[model samples]
Target: MDPYRRLVRPALFRLDPERTHEAAIALAERVGRRLPRAQIDPALEVTAMGLRFPSPIGLAAGFDKGARAVDAWAAVGFGFAEVGTVTPEPQAGNPRPRMFRLGSDHALINRLGFNNPGSVVVASRLAAARARGRVAIPIGVNVGKSRDTLAERAVHDYAAAVERLWPYADYVVVNVSSPNTPGLRDLQARSALGEILTAVLDVDVRSAEWSGEPRRPVLVKLAPDLSDEQVDAVTELALELELAGVVVSNTTLSRAGLRSPAAMTSEEGGLSGAPLRLRSTELVGRVARRAEGALAVVGVGGVSSARDAWDKLAAGASLVQLYTALVYEGPSLVRRINRELARMMRERGIERVADIRSAG
Candidate 1:
């Protein structure tokens, strides 16, 4: 039996979702050295954004918002791990009770409001992790604007994050889709998104030059709630920006077809997990059709099973990530997904995630 679901999850679930997460992070830090290794499959190897990942299954951002326990992800057997949704300045984030669990739905609702210790502190932690040689896999930083930052000034916050965090980031994820932040989604529009990407890309260039490092890969995270036309617009924008990839979604506010209680389901936050799978995969297909394979797509949302992960790949995602699934399935979820994915590919005389998409 999966120890997490059999034992750990029950105990953790007893507390609120956020508390369980915090407790786990603390435990990971103290016992990470003893954590069992995740089984790695050769077929799971993938190259995206000019970077190689040991596997395509990665831990999505929002779990390690402060960049702490970054090194623990590798020990837990993730192909990669992304940290932060950090802003330029620290903010308490919406009020208490901002995070909730919908166990019946295998989903989560969070209005964390880009909560973190701010970019500077998070950057320092990441730098420290890199210097200490703590991480076993590639690490990306997810950057966003602060709550108090006006919509027009969002670019400055993004640029600042890229400038300070790219030195330690394998890539930088520009998050403009979180429903928790007011007017943040407005940045997803063509004109606004273009300006933000332009400023960040410019800073990315200068940061590379100043740090004497190679140009860092930049990606934008989109929302699952966008209209089909909006998805197409963002795809075109990403293509024009020549971005490394697009993280197919951040979260959604839609509670359609959810089985959670009305109160929990009605909470104001982005929804993630099983409820989001079909829509997210559908969005991946739309974006991929629009991309024509020019840029990469990292799939997130509702990937609780290998088939779900495979579905995303077949639809056009070169990589996949999950946060809520881990909460419900356990850390072994990574190894299980990779093993099943590799087996599924081998059975079809296929190899690599991209081939899965190409075959379709």
Candidate 2:
């Protein structure tokens, strides 16, 4: 008898998917202060990237692309929220009908192409939110190359975003793995990624010196489609660059074993949700194995329940995030997952989330 599943979802699902999402964001913006906050078990608190998260579960990037719902996300019980796949300049993004729902499989396909209100506007919104003291949790900004930027100039594009948005960002994620933007994933090449990250680090150093605040930790969001060697290389590069962590994966291009209609599945976009769970978890474990305690791993992709979150934690993810599942399971899913994670921890006599992989 979950209210969202039986009542809210049916009505929301009737609209086109993107429209439904727009409506959701609009509602969150309006009712954020009035919405009841979800409580987390004290035992679930996590320490990663030198910040304390009230819970280990976070809302992944792409949902709140413009930092519009920063307060709302914390009110809804997320330990932290990562906003944006924001670009240096604004663009309308790919044409309409870009997002599709796969109800049968509890998944989605989208080619939204990082449609956002650019860095300047988004930075303004974040500044406003912070000025009001409405921010309740750490907010990470995820930056992507502008669609019009040439591949050779990608480093400057990402560095510009980090430089512009760093003041408000508790952490930053260099997004080179989203498949929706052309030539985006190609930047994941070791040499190319190294250059981009190095430039971003340089920005971080300057920002810290200028503001007199601690340097914001930086992470890289990678794709789930990389080969084992590619994954290891990126993991090594993260350690070499002294990155705070890696977000182990954006959505995938793979469409294997789907129950959705052929027409829906045939749409050109990255796939997310249940179909991505196993592979994402596997990649997280791979990165963790390679990092060997040197880097934090933020696990994402297809987590719908507490068990799924636990699987990622046990696989070596220090923190976990969700997006597609929220589409299917609704907001209360966050509280339910955290509560269940606490119960599971109690049953196993574990104290903190970061110790999961080691305890296993």
Clashing pairs in 2: none
Q: In the order shown, what is each candidate's alpha-carbon RMSD?
A: 1.3, 0.9
Off by over 4 Å in 1: 33-37
Q: What's the C-alpha lDDT at position 154 in model 1?
A: 87
Count of clashes, each model:
1, 0
lDDT of 1 by residue, 1-360 (tens): 867788888888889888788888888777765565565887788998888888888999999899878878887878898998988887778887888899999999998887799888988888777787767788989999988888888889898877778788898899999998889999999999999999999998888788788998888999998999999999999998899889988889899999888988988889998999999999989998889888789999999888998899999998899999988998778888888888899999996677998776
User: In model 2, where do residues sit more than 4 Å from their true spots?
Assistant: none
What lDDT is obtained when candidate 1 is compared to the true structure?
0.87
- Scored against the true structure, residue 55 in model 2 reaches a CA lDDT of 92
Q: Worst ten-residue run, lDDT, model 1?
A: 30-39
lDDT of 2 by residue, 1-360 (tens): 899999999999999999999988988988885665667899999888899999989999999998887879877889999999889887789999999999998999999999999999999999998997878788999999988899999999999999999999999999999999999999999999999999999999999999999999899999999999999999999999999999998999999999988989999999999999999999999999889878889999999999999999999999999999999889889999999999988898898887777777
The estimated TM-scores of all candidates read 0.97, 0.98
| lDDT for position 29 in model 1 | 70
